[model samples]
Target: MEQAQMPGCYRHPGVETGVRCTRCERPICHACMVDAAVGFQCPECVRDGSGTGHSRTANQPRTIAGGRITAGHPHLVTQVLIGLNLLIFLLGRLNPALIDETVLIGFAFDPDLGRVVGVADGEWYRLVTSMFLHQEVWHIAGNMLLLWLLGGTLEEELGRVRYLTLYLLSGLAGSAFTYLIAAENQGSLGASGAIYGLLGATVVLVRRLNRDMRPIMALVVINLVITFAWDGIAWEAHIGGLIAGVILAYAMVNGPRERRALLQGAACALVLGLTLATVVLRTAALT
Candidate 1:
């Protein structure tokens, strides 16, 4: 009787092998084999079986972690933003005299002053810095609470760079709108506008995922009511930030999966460019 020829490994045809992939039952050499829960599997089987037990959807945003955001991981960007706001607020409290002449003058969004003093006069920084300033205890507390709630989710989904970009651009949007609508010499300060942007982003993100929007809508509506009902609130800023957030989020959600980073960056640049143009035109009109 002649001896039978043994089957060779699928990946290495030249080598004969008795070992087989547990998942695909194909002959596999040690080099092509991957460890599985129950037994060994081929590379192709291992690749196909990844995340087979999880419940993630196709529409869900991908992150650096290769998994959904969990409570175990800390939202570092959100925490840093909150800390910066608190630190500024504390500094303002420590030196009460700095509120007007120093802090607000140097950082708060003052369209009238910006128009007159101009960027050469150091008012340009206010567009970015104003988002970190808070005067009253309630103001800082409320903004921080909202930032914690919304920022964590947005940061987790969008990642740090995108989250920070959305925030700063949102602030600039708010300031631009305030400059266009606010009375001359009126100074505004707070992270409320950026926080509102986060809310709008949340709405767009939820809608993209085909999830319920009522809860998020309710939050927005309530905030809008408060914005209009309260005295001295910059409803213009809130509205501007919300609109920017919606547009930015839409761009992000609709972007191609393979070119997401490029698309997102382009969207942010468009928004920033439009905002800058508006400011320039408004300032020219004032001049």
Candidate 2:
């Protein structure tokens, strides 16, 4: 007796799969399988309906990452993020202490709070909170405006879940990078890191779609110049977020149709793990 090799997906030739599309009997990987009334169907069968009098499958409308296509305010996640940032900023204004407590720092002695506080001191929440903190109107304004412009399209294109994951992980990666290299007492807070991540993601998306690339490329170059030229800007966060976003967006958009979700999830996990490791190493160095 001889063993037969598993067949690959019709659309993705690289994924080894044992399942076949019920409609056309073509092999399909999980990424390309669309649920049907009878059984799973391939994307082509799901799209055309093949004059079989079958209604369009409920699972037909999917994003580039296989996320469900949301109707009516597809950018809901983006809207919520902006709203939350604004609300936090307002709170910080009302209670200036909130800014002191939340701003990103590896380690710092807070004279007002009369205590040593920082990520190394176990206030790790700062990594996330700092992304939403802004003392200056100009800082928040610039960030929110960029988020509105870039986030809406990216959210719609990548769908809510992937877009949110990319945003958060990018922000965390930025915070981790800042903690790893920036002076322990150095204070940094802003959404610029996350926005830069979106900027990098936009570049990847534009490239994937084969659209004109000059505008996005120019935007990135200009921001890089600003990141380095400016005195207070955290260049570490910007570079870290940009790199994480590029890696994640590439995985999200171009993961092979065979086990694509698994691959993308692994990429996300890799970023998170590396970021966590970096933070831990820095914490040890500080202590």
Candidate 3:
């Protein structure tokens, strides 16, 4: 009698193989083989045995909408903001003249000029530009550190566009508050207002997630104390930013899920409108 040749792998008909699946006794190619404790098995056998106690299946992590969560990474927007701030600071250092002529007079929030000379006279941009300006090394260092910490978390949760919007709005709110209350001829410039806004946003987001808010609350209290204790600190800006952040976060989190985007946009627009109105009223009072 003639000896029979070993059958070819089912997955690869052209090639001949001696390998046999332990479970199904089917010939398997290297590509189709699944390693088992006892022996190699064919893909079909492995799939068939997947329901057994020894078999395991991996589950993808999901979010609110049954969508799978993507891999986590550092927040880009936060990093970019930090870089821009540092670059501006370095440039100001190189040209001290820039601080007086460009940063302070033209960009830093000057309540007296903003109210008296008006925005068209080069005071309007200060509300926004002030956020990226810092007078001292320690000032930028502290603000940047806080921003790196809190901003990353906010950006991850709220996404780039929303986080950026919140940050600028909060900063503007801080400037507006300062304009309304600060002494005439007093000028403010720093990222402190925006950093405070991040802290407030973190608190609101934590509350929304039903997580403990004690640690964050403690931080807020401590920072507020520091703000008051230190001379030349813009406590008003801190308070204003915090209030604006809380309101904005609350509006975003509590809005209807079906129309969340729309609601958030409306809420932000409303806050901005109120800020503009406050500026108008304050300027009018001065005039």
Q: What is the TM-score of each candidate against the true structure?
A: 0.71, 0.82, 0.70
lDDT of 1 by residue, 78-158 (tens): 888888889888988897544454322212344533443433244566666677888898988988898898888777656
Per-residue C-alpha lDDT of model 2 across residues 60-102, encoded as one tens digit per residue: 6466677766657878999999999999999999999998999
Which ten contiguous residues of candidate 3 have the minimum total lDDT?
60-69
- Which model scores highest in lDDT? 2
Q: What does the lDDT come to for candidate 1?
A: 0.70
Q: Could you tell which candidate, 1 or 3, scores higher by TM-score?
A: 1
Against the reference, the lDDT scores of all candidates come to 0.70, 0.86, 0.71
RMSD of each: 12.6, 7.3, 15.8
Worst 10 residues of 1 by lDDT: 57-66
| Number of backbone clashes in candidate 1 | 0
Q: Is candidate 2 or candidate 3 better by TM-score?
A: 2
